[model samples]
Target chain A: MNRFIARNGPAYAFLLPWFLGFFLLALGPILASLYLSFTRYDMVAEPRWVGFDNYVYMFTRDRRFWKALNVTFTYVALAVPARLIMALVVAMLLDKGLRTIGVYRAIFYLPSLLGSSIAIAILWRQLFAADGVVNRVLADFGIPSHAWITDPNTSIYTLVLLAMWQFGSPMLIFLAGLRSIPRDLYEAAEIDGTPKWRQFLRITLPLLAPVIFFNLVLQTIEAFKTFSSAFIISNGSGAPADSLLFYTVYLFNEAFKFFRMGYASALAWVLLIIIAVFTGIAFLTSKYWVHYENERD
Target chain B: MVEMTRRKLLGTAAAGVAASALVGVPALAATRIRHYWWGNPERDKRTFAVIDLFQKANPGIEVSGETIGWGDYWTKMATQTAGRNMADLVQMDYRYLFEYVRRGALKPLDEYIGKSLMIQDFDKGPIDGGRVDGKLYALNIGANSQVMVYNTRVFQEAGVDADLINWTWDDFAKACEKISAKSGGKVKGADDLALMIEVFESWVRQNGREFYDANGKVAATVDDVATFWQFWADLRKKDVVRSKDKTVILDVPIAESGIAVGDTAMSQFWSNQLVGIQAVSKDKIGAAMVPHKAGGKPGQYIKPSMFMSLSRDVKDPASAIAYMNAWVNDPAITKVLGLERGIPVSQKIRDQLAPGLSEVEKLSINYFTAIQNKVGGLPLPAPKGAGEVRDAFMRTGSDVVLARTSVKDAAASFIDDAQAIIDRAQ
Candidate 1:
């Protein structure tokens, strides 16, 4: 033991802060919440062990929970693909040889940095308002407009648009992926009398599959965890007929507003399991499509 | 040489830590208490000034003030309560006072009432308004009631009577239709009042029913809710009231409400919010009673705007109670606060501050003053799960107005969910 401690003491010392943080802050709360998922706790009173009552009620009776799941799933389904496509399109444009490409990249990246802020959420709300700038611009063409943010049917789409607007991070990663592809492959395809569209399909897409898979997984997880924008635009009560009630917003309301901490804990575990299932599916299917250059035949 | 320097660095850090600990021990002897409140900038300024004065008077007692917006206040309070580190003096809402007290998160102030907490001059009604289970757990900070605030200019432009004191629901509806017609569809007549639970409570009372009975169960029925929702739905269909979109826009601060922005002629607001509404409006603002039920009971009652309660685990009860006493009874503090929080609960403080009040302030004071004696009995304290019930009720009401659900179906589901929540909480 003494020899082992002497050999690795400095490395252990360097890692102590992170180890302490994990055990005390992250791990403790996670385990506590797992235990709390089986209870009835209103925060002020003692938690009573009800043994899956919260989960039973959530699955069988809580209509709002189902609504939240539906909203979140719809948001994820739309936002993930929309954001990835926008990122790839912008990234492909930036891949062209231009002297001011760096400046354009910086400008495109500004949105992701400011996207999740409360101010941006408020601005997005105004932009989609009934008489807001979008409507004014649309009215110039003599097209009738509707209240975008307040209309239940169209409100989630506004959030999806906001997600699309913040395609900066993935765009950067895609730009890196685009640059790493060899120029000679495209040149050789062109010399062999391949059209631009066919060249893209045969060469560019197969090589970029790994990057696309990476972005898809990352963006899908981030979309499921969306809270602040939904919370702010919905006015914190999932307003306008609960159409904007994302999963995290609903969990936050249940935990804090309604003081249903136990139920919220149960909801949180269910969400974790859902995200895990999605990620596991992505990994298990990756071998069929996402090929690595260094892999053995 | 490098090894010697590293050892010296470690010794210096140890010495610095030891010196700070020695300094902190002396500072710990002085009693420090935290006060938490939810308010806007104006209330924060006044509350901080009062805390400053209290700290100056009692040199050994250091009082720290914390304030948050109303939206996040209860969430923070619940987190603090769960951590067993609630502020010594907690600013509480009436709907939450019962929950906090019943959960044993708040200390009963009855034992200290005659001693450190001096509120003998306060009115008995306000005092009793703070009680739960016959125990005084909080002290009323101010008294106010619900009212309909209207723009006088809109009434004149529409050539409609502005006196809403005796207007029945039918008369009010006719007036609203006339106002909308007069505006040529530019200005809505009133906000969608069905969105507010407080306004619905008054309607329930006007119909000679209690919202919640003595047993803390829902006393208002599905028919009552359906009738109220259908009335607003019919008004919405006629475009006499703010549309669902407009209502969503105005569901913000009182200063940004429909009446304040000239988009609507009138809206339902707390009696105290008239001053805030008047401040933002270019038109002449006026306060009047919410329309009555023709021959039914007077629904309006004096409500404690908020309460100052002591945490059950307050480290220094005497100091905290003394601050509460000064906040309620001190003439100088009352002048600084004015009618911003609500009308002062103490008659002496109200009379003392009456002479220097602004015209807009007097509008709220007069509105509450005239109705103080004639209003009905106070309703029972809201039950433990009332917060959830209120939000669910508002969502259901919005569903009705947005035409997403029929009034009867919305009311039925709301009643079912509210009863389930209340039952599960018990």
Candidate 2:
């Protein structure tokens, strides 16, 4: 035992702080929230065990629960593809062209860094308000300005535009992927007199599948967890007829605003499951399309 | 060598114990008090200034002050309460007073009343506003009521007089129409308040009823609310008030709202917010009673803006009470404070600050005192889950304006759903 301890002592000491925090700070609250999910716990009082009551109420009676789920799913479905495709297109544009693309890349990459911050969210609200810059620009074009952010039908679309605006990180990753593609294959296709579009369809698409899959999984999860932008935009009440009621926003309101911590815990677990199922599906489907360059096909 | 080392170790042990005892006992003797609140920069400035004065007055005590912005305050406060580490003094909202008191996070100040509180000159109405379950748990910092705030410059541009004291709903609508036509579409007449709690309370009160009934159900009849909704909707149709896109940002806060930006000439808000809005626009803003029915019991209730209470974790009640005494009853501090919080609760301080008030402060004091007898009792303390119900009001109101739901149906459904939410609290 002494010999084993001596061998592993340095590693153990290195991990000691993180191990302590994990168990004490993280694991403790995780288990506590799990227990509370089965109880009727308000912040004000002791949690009374009412096993599965919160889940039951959520599945059976809560219309807003259903609405929140619908909004989140719609957001994920819209934001993920739009953002990734935008990244890929811009990456392609810079991969073969633009001598000073580094400057442009840095400029483009700035939005993703600030995308989820409260300040950016607030700025987005002002930019899309009725008298804001977007409408003013539209008015100059003689297209007639509309209430883009306030209209329930178009509010979610404005959020999608915000997500799409932050395509920088993904574009960087895509550029790296593009650069790594062997030039010999493209040269051989060119020698064979293949059309540019044909070469792109046959080779580039297949080669870039793995990166696309990676981005799809990552962005989908990130989209599901969106909170700050919607919260700031809607003033935390999911107003304009609850059109901005993202699942996380609703969960936050339940936990903090209404102090129904138990119900919020239940909602949180449901979000975890939803994200897991989508991620699992992406991984399961990757075998069909995502191929590594190292494969000996 | 062994004998010398053992003697030295024993000597150090004795000294350490003595030092610890000396250090710990004085902690008990220090009379240190911790206070916490959430407010703007000016409020923090005035509060610290008063603390400086108090510290100078009593050199024996040490006080610590902490401030947080309003957006994050409640979350931090709840965490502190749950941890049983709340500050000795708490700045609480009237909407949240019952919640804190019910949770036993607040200390009942009845025993210290008239002694530490020095409420001898305090009015009964605002004081009674802080009681829960027949126990005086806290004291209000001041009183306020809902009123219409207007920009006097805009009123002149629209060729309208500044007085709206005895105006009816119809009169308000006509003014909006006239102001809209006169401005040549530059400024809206007034911002919509359809989604606000103050507006709902005032409207129901004007109809000779209250917003919440005896059973704590929403008492504003469906027809009454529908009529008001229809009024705002018709105004929207006429472009008198804001249209759909602009209405989306309706009456957010005084500083950020359309009124501050000169898009609207007037807005309905609590009298407590007078200083904030006036400071925002740097324009001459006027306060008038919310337009009532032409002839009925005036339905403007003077209510407490906020209450200050003792936390359950207080170390020294006397020191905390001393701070509270100076906060409410001291004339020098209240005069410095002016109407930042609201009308001063103490009669002596109110009379003292009266002559020294600016034109804006005088507007609030005169309007509140004028409407003192006209309004009904403060609506029943909103029940638990009241936050959810209040949010529902906004959602339903928006649905009506967006024409997603008929006004009558929306009103009926909202009333039923709101009542059900309140019932769920039981």
Candidate 3:
């Protein structure tokens, strides 16, 4: 132990700052929020412990809590798969040695690069507004315009479209994963007279499992936590009847808008648990599908 | 994205250096006060001008101002208060005053009244409005009556003479329909009524009841709320006002609002917003009182535009009070502020500035002043959970217009929701 410490002391010294930051900056607030979820706080005043009141109220009383959960889950269900499929499709296209593929990748990557920003959210709002360019373009094609973001029935779909539009980062990851797949495997399959579709299903699908899993978990979490675009499109009030009321937006309104800090803390904890559960489900389910090259299982 | 992170890191490093540099300066050598407020650009310009005047008048006192948009201001204020980094002075709203005072976030100004505030000729009506629990916690900046601001062009185009001063709900409906028909569907009459809290409050008042009681309960009956929704829904059906979808589309900014764009004839607005709304167009916009039910009490009553109060953690209450005095009572500030904050609450300032007032300012002042004797008593002070109630009101309004629920059911559910929220807060 002494000899190992002596050898790794310099490495440990270099990592000390990050370790300290992880404990102090990241973990501290997380634990504090957990404690706060059990309390009644208005931010301006002292937090009071109310045992399980916040949890009980959330489960049995708060209608908005249920609505937010429903909206968030629906969004994750629709957006994650749609975005991942689009990413995989585009990555496959770019995997072939097409000229200007780099430029095309960069251009495709631009939307996700700018996706989470408030400016892009504002631009998205403008494009999807009732009289916006989307409607104007539709009119040119003799298709009547629909209130895309304004109508309650269609607002969440616009956000799903936005989520799908930002498939760039995952696409890039998929492209990298695709490149790492050995060419011999596909060539051998083709030599056996396997059809291209069958080879893709058997070879590409199995080889890309780790990358696909990563993209799925990352995007599902992101879709659950989406705030700015929905918040902006809904004018920060979650209106045209709360259709754009994403979970994070609802939590924000509860904490900041209504000063229900304790309730918001509980909402945050619930969101953390929900994401953990979904991620857990993904991992438990992945063993049957995801194949690692050296895994004995 | 790569550029954003690099710039952010640089910004943090620069801020660290600047903060460390600031550590050397003594903070209390001179009385330094930080004031925070939410306002539009015009009001910001006017307030800054007044601050400059005050600074010139008192060189020993150093004052800095910070501002945010109205929507985000309260969130920032609550976060600051929680962090104990509250500004020495804050501009407050009537809806939020009770909540802040109840939470001990505001400083009581009763002790400083005679010493710091020179209110010799100040009107009691405006002063009394700022008191909470019979103790002065804030000072009124200005008071404005609710008004119906109309674009003259739209009204003319519709060939509708909306005499808003003596108009009733029925009259408003007929005029809207006329305007919609006359314009050949190029414009709707109004989509404004459904979302306005004050408008609903005033409707209940005209029916001889306040929308919210002194306890901040939902004072209006289901019938009262139902009637309000039914009125707008009927108007929607007749195409007198915009449909729910159209309403949401025009909900961007006043610049793009139906009235400002000459798509609607009129909207209910506070008198102080007259200039900002009129600034978007050269259409000779006009102002008149809000309509009420026939043979009912007047729907127009003055509301304090905002209040200026001392923070509970003020470093120098005396300096803060002195600055507040200069802001409210000094005649010179009247020239700089004009009617940007609504009519000046100080009688001396109002009389002093009346002669030099611009046409727009004069119109806001004259409209409210003319309706002085007609307006009902002041609406009850908003209670602790007022913000949530207001939101519920808005949500309920949307629910009604979208036919997600019937008007009566929405009203009943809103009452239940508001009561539960208020009770839970208690």
lDDT for residue A263 in candidate 1, whole number 0-100: 92
Q: After superposition, how far is residue B144 of candidate 3 from its true place, in Å?
A: 0.7
Q: What are the chain A TM-scores for all the models, listed individually? A: 0.93, 0.90, 0.93
Which candidate's TM-score is highest? 1
- Return the TM-score for each candidate structure: 0.95, 0.90, 0.94
Candidate with more favorable, higher TM-score: 2 or 3 = 3
lDDT of 2 by residue, A212-237 (tens): 88888889999999999999988887
The parts of candidate 3 lying over 4 Å away from their true place are A1-18, B1-29, B249-252
Write the number of the candidate with greater DockQ, choosing between 1 and 2: 1
- Sort by TM-score, best first: what order? 1, 3, 2
Query: Reference contacts recovered by each candidate, as fractions?
Result: 0.78, 0.57, 0.72
The candidate 1 chain B region of ten consecutive residues with least summed lDDT is: B246-255
Model 1: per-residue Cα lDDT over B92-154, one tens digit each: 889888788878999888888778888877889888898887989888888788888888988
DockQ of each: 0.65, 0.46, 0.61
Indicate the residue-level lDDT of A197 in model 1: 91
Clashing pairs in 3: none
